[model samples]
Target: MISKKIGLVESIASKSNGLDDIRVKINGEIQRAYNYPKLTGEVNIGDEVVLNTTAVELSLGTGGYHFVISNLNNMESNFTPGGHIMKLRYTPLQVKVDAVEEQESPYHDAIEEFESLENMPVVVGTLHSMLTPFVASYKRNNPSKKLVYIMTDGASLPIYLSKNVDTLKNKKLIDSTITIGNAFGGDYECINIYTALITAKEILKADVVFVSMGPGIAGTGTKYGFTGIEQGPILDAVKKLKGMPVAIPRVSFADQRDRHMGISHHSLTVLNDIVNVEVNIPITTYEDEKLDVVKRQIETKELDKKHHIVYINNKNTEEDLNYFGLSVRSMGRNYQQDKEFFDAASSAAYYLMEVCDDSRRENY
Candidate 1:
């Protein structure tokens, strides 16, 4: 169920290509809200808007912001029928997008005639937060290589919700964006990860592609019940498509939960069980016992027989992030707070760069 209320748009906090962060006065209380211009026309100051207060009412982690359902002062809909391919299908907010693989799309023939990814390096991260550091590390050495981001619909459906994506773009860390599955607002859109990878290779001409979710990953506290499980299929898809699959394990010592202590069980499950393809699993080097614990988890699962474990020392993640003028935090923990976590992502990035260089030498 949804809880909604009419609110007055007090001010436009910020505005971007397809999103607007605004302040609204609801029931004599000022609150933050988001406005999607394509769905409901832009909201300006003094405009009365219908706000969806569902997440806020339930005290969910939407950063305490409501979503603008409609702008009363601007009743005109700004939506354009981009294509017949629909995202959020059958929902009240269903939106049409020009998926690259769709028949009507200009690149439909290119997608249909696609042969393979030609050993292109694809880094698969479990969390949305991994995008920044991974991009930073990869681009740090390969500045000339084009790195495309393939955002899966494992978390937020709209790509506009990720300020991290915007930051990476602003700094030119990422060369292109492709939203796959139900996620929208990327530079390119595809119906699934397979087509998205093909599009990245053929259409975008990307040297490396990063696959991850947007933001707000869901977890139900049960094994195989988290959104991060998508990493398994994403990695498998890359290998099946003849691309190099490199997985960044979710590692953390700061997380208070038992499951996320050394190497996250989510990553373990994906690396050990879900993914059938033998992929490169990069791990970070540590001075403390963190390394041992991570190795134990892998050995305990007999992951060595199924995958290639690459030990990479990447302590320059913070420096890399700082060099790009970007800061990222996962689960409310900054790089320092969760050094192993970011390092793990950076380690994969380091390894991916090595693989990507080799791929270019052979394929290009």
Candidate 2:
């Protein structure tokens, strides 16, 4: 029994005319017998026998050269004809833009105005972060009576911080502003920011909810929570809220990796697909079992207003985080390029909420 793997001959040194005298052996057993008219047998066993190799070309294959072996006479004699054969074929890839932006309702004219020349929205990091610029930006374009920031965290912390900077709490704006956020954990903490506002039906129940995955300390700078993998628990909460998410572009791109497993499911969008998009929320526990559940949530919006309150498994590999950060920096021109896209998407959502506040008041 010959157990040796076969090797294809590419070329031979001599051009002796013996078209049917070629012989090949494996483990002392003859495997192939053929003749090459222009090839000589005066070569060592391990010598590279260059043959007329053919390239296998087909669609859906990466464009690269591959050698081909066939049992044809004079196969080792046609190097010039077979060596340059192209093996792989090429196919074009397509990308579709799924987002769209629309104009604000005229109702906003009653409560506020927009920036003089800037159509883009302002950035508000979190409740505890600076409020002056966001609030001032809104007020500059609109009348005071109609201007307001819907509160999420019921605590007076945002108000206190604002007062410290001489921006008095506009009692009227406070009244108009909507408050959302679960004093206790709820199904959709982020959605609660909206549902709570909608439940009030107040003109400014919610302007925007800055979402961050938790179990980490709440503070500004590079230390806040809500990294990529933490998405699972937050998304579980969202599933219960009957609300969609507003994911940023970078997050969307990363989430695609897990789409096949259904762990990174749900291409959620909000505000007519202009503000936010909810993409891949990771698997919490026994992720393999929950794949169908995640897929169900993504494929069909079967679950309604049932918020699922969950505690985040705060364990994270700091090494992985650092590695991802390094990779992002290496792939892009700068770190901000990776972060900026998501930031802009979030800002768009905030702008949508700000504009909607004015219109909601007119209808109220």
lDDT by candidate, in order shown: 0.87, 0.28
Cα deviation at 198, candidate 2, in Å, is 1.0
Q: Which stretches of candidate 1 lie over 4 Å from their true place?
A: 62-64, 358-364
Give per-residue CA lDDT, model 1, range 1-364, as digits (tens). 8889999999998998778999999999999999988877778899999999988998976335699888888887645666788898998888888889878789999999999888888899978999998888888878998999999999888898899988889888888999988899899988999999999999998988899999888888788999899999998899899988888889899999999989888988888879989998888888668788988998999888899888887779999988888888998889889989888888887886655554353642
**In lDDT terms, which candidate is top?**
1
In lDDT terms, how accurate is model 2? 0.28
> Compared with the true structure, what per-residue lDDT tens digits does model 2 show for residues 124-229?
2222222332233333334333333333443331111223122224322222323233221121112233343232222333333333321111222221232222
TM-score of each: 0.96, 0.25
